[model samples]
Target: MDPHQANAMTTLSLFAHARALTAALACFGAAAIVTASGSTAHASPPASKKDSKAMTTSKPCPKGNLERSQCMIRLLLDDVAKTYDGSGGGGISAIRALNTTTFAVSLPQEGRIDVLTYEFELHPDGRVAIKSRTPSTQNVGPGTGK
Candidate 1:
């Protein structure tokens, strides 16, 4: 093979290797981001044995269980909003807890006034289970409600 041709082939191979390395790095970076976000969303304080017993026997919030629940829901909703993409105008608006471990969140979609409801289950082990449902649009007449 000509010396010039051999040198050209070597350079091409080097460029291909570099491209592969770059792609691998990009994938790794994406994976890291996903993992970090997931961890942040699920991170919670671990309950000790005594705390677990207290939780089981403790009385519900006296001020108003619903209000207390709403406070917790608001915190979770805030986190969701922070993580959500706001460029599309689709994100969580409110949240309500139906029970100690179950809660629902309201999400607004792009170009729509209706809020979608989502259910989430909070586990003692810092795990969160989320379920999304189809959203219905709000109906409004032409002249507004004058």
Candidate 2:
């Protein structure tokens, strides 16, 4: 073959290789992004408001005690205010139980008193049970108020 023709073929081949390589790299980058997005989608939901506040404000509970008791109190108070139409007339009270931690608040209005008592029981799995009691008896979920 002529030298000019050979050189032209070589240049075309090199260009093709470069385009293929670029396409491969782009595919890899897209795959990585898709994989990361899928993993995040499947991951656990974001922390609740109470959980975040607890981590930020409360001291770490002992290995055998309730975790973030102070934060729990704040969360409960906020819940009470929301539930009672911004009428949070309760005063918070805390006491150490025989083998647990107890927090109580009294909401007195007119002639009715609503008591919110949270009994915290720490388990081996590092979860706390915040049992809230009102005059009508409502159970809030773990790590949340109201």
Candidate 3:
């Protein structure tokens, strides 16, 4: 990725994180909105209205890492919680295309499930349709269920 584009992505991601922080803080006025372990941090409000227009499901995604940026992932993960097991618990970290069409999404390390990666592909019709979700394993760790 170009340095400028990388910078822009960083800026955009920071802005989004800030926005999430603001919304989270403002929502409850307490630090409970964010968790240090990241095991249970609440998601911020949806991107602003203009973000919808900026992020279209069409080809030629905006500048930056189109395949990995939050914009693309957010748009694609509209109903991610519906199918991705254990997705409801932790946050998403990365989205990498294993091939031209297949993508490997990195999920947060839940208790006893470290380095879990899910490979999926979107429908050719330009929608968030998952063709399949086969996972590759790594290792596990102890986690507090409390």
Candidate 4:
């Protein structure tokens, strides 16, 4: 083949190779990001033996002999789980009573290190409602830690 034609062919080959490499790299980068985000989406820690035992030992307050506050907390946690995760998986780690009808709760969410704090109130219809919520990393409300 002519020198000019050979060089042109080589250039085209190189361009094609480079384009294929770029596409492959982009696909790999996108896959990596998806994997990372998927991993971070469910950021709750694995349950330890002690934590598992604590969960098992603590029965649902209505059927068992647990305290009223404990039962209400369990129900609240269930509600939060339903609202946030669509499944009954998450649990509140800490709860502090603001008053007989109001309280603050702290729990961890997927992809976050800091706990989320929410103010909760018992409605007149016997339903629990979250009044307000704030992230714990910022200087916010009372239930601020893990």
Between candidates 2 and 4, the one scoring higher on TM-score is: 2
Error of 3 at 95 (Å): 1.6
Candidate 4 per-residue lDDT over residues 76-105, each given as its tens digit: 343333334312213333344444433455
Native-vs-model 1 lDDT? 0.33
Better of 3 and 4 by TM-score: 3
Q: Rate the local accuracy (lDDT) of all candidates.
A: 0.33, 0.33, 0.37, 0.33
Candidate 2 per-residue C-alpha lDDT over 61-85 given as tens digits, one digit per residue, 9 for 90 to 100:
3342112443343334434433443
For residue 18, model 4's alpha carbon misses the true position, in angstroms, by: 44
Which structure is stronger by TM-score: 2 or 3?
3
Q: Best by TM-score, which number?
A: 3
Worst 10-residue lDDT window for candidate 1 reads: 31-40
**How close is every model to the real structure, measured as TM-score?**
0.29, 0.34, 0.36, 0.29
Off by over 4 Å in 4: 1-66, 85-91, 109-146
Candidate 3 displacement at residue 100 in angstroms: 1.7
What C-alpha lDDT, on a 0 to 100 scale, does residue 59 get in candidate 3?
Answer: 34
CA lDDT, candidate 4, residue 75: 36
Question: Compared with the true structure, what per-residue lDDT tens digits does model 1 show for residues 72-116?
Answer: 333343334333333343333433334453444444444443443
